[model samples]
Target: MRLEQWSRIMGKLAIDDEVLEEVAAAARSRGVSSESLAQELLLEGLRGHKSKESLRQLMEAIAAMTSRDVEQTDSVELLREDRDR
Candidate 1:
């Protein structure tokens, strides 16, 4: 809604027709303009980019999780026990 944000999105961007149509349909179903829907989609993508963790960090997290003893236990119980520990 701000002038800076509006200026940033003024340039053209490429998208497939099927994806555009889907975005338009969702906008209509939600009683919003297609432009608004597109903006929402773009913002969601940008937020995801900004928040994504590095591959090394992800691998480290996975290694830490898998190193714990989870044999013969349901995932939920394993997670609870891990958290308790």
Candidate 2:
């Protein structure tokens, strides 16, 4: 189920005193509501993880790649010659 398919709804969450204090401090530092701070923090943390999954999927497609798909960027022969000098 995706968000766009839903009727927009506000959900409830319960935070402990310790967690709420951290949120409050973050909110003050960022000049935003604790709710906004929490949402931003959640998105920031989760977005990187979500992109890594997509990147892993893209990398998996390399199983079908031929030699032409590879672009050699290393200087193995140059390094070996330089080393023998």
lDDT of 2: 0.69
Q: Please write out the lDDT profile of model 2 over residues 1-85, one tens digit for every residue.
A: 1222222433555556687778878899988876677778888998757577788887878755647668765699779989999
Lowest lDDT 10-mer window, candidate 2?
1-10
For candidate 1, give the lDDT: 0.74
Cα misplacement distance, residue 20 of candidate 1 (Å): 1.2
Candidate 2's error at 50, in angstroms? 4.6
The C-alpha TM-scores of every prediction are 0.50, 0.44
| Residue pairs in clash, model 1 | none
On lDDT, the leading prediction is 1
* Candidate 2, number of clashes: 0
Cα-based lDDT at residue 45, candidate 2: 91
Task: Tell me the whole-model lDDT of each prediction, alpha carbons only.
Answer: 0.74, 0.69
- Tens digits of per-residue lDDT, candidate 1, 1-82, equal 3334445677656667777778878999999977898898889998777334676788788788774676556889989999
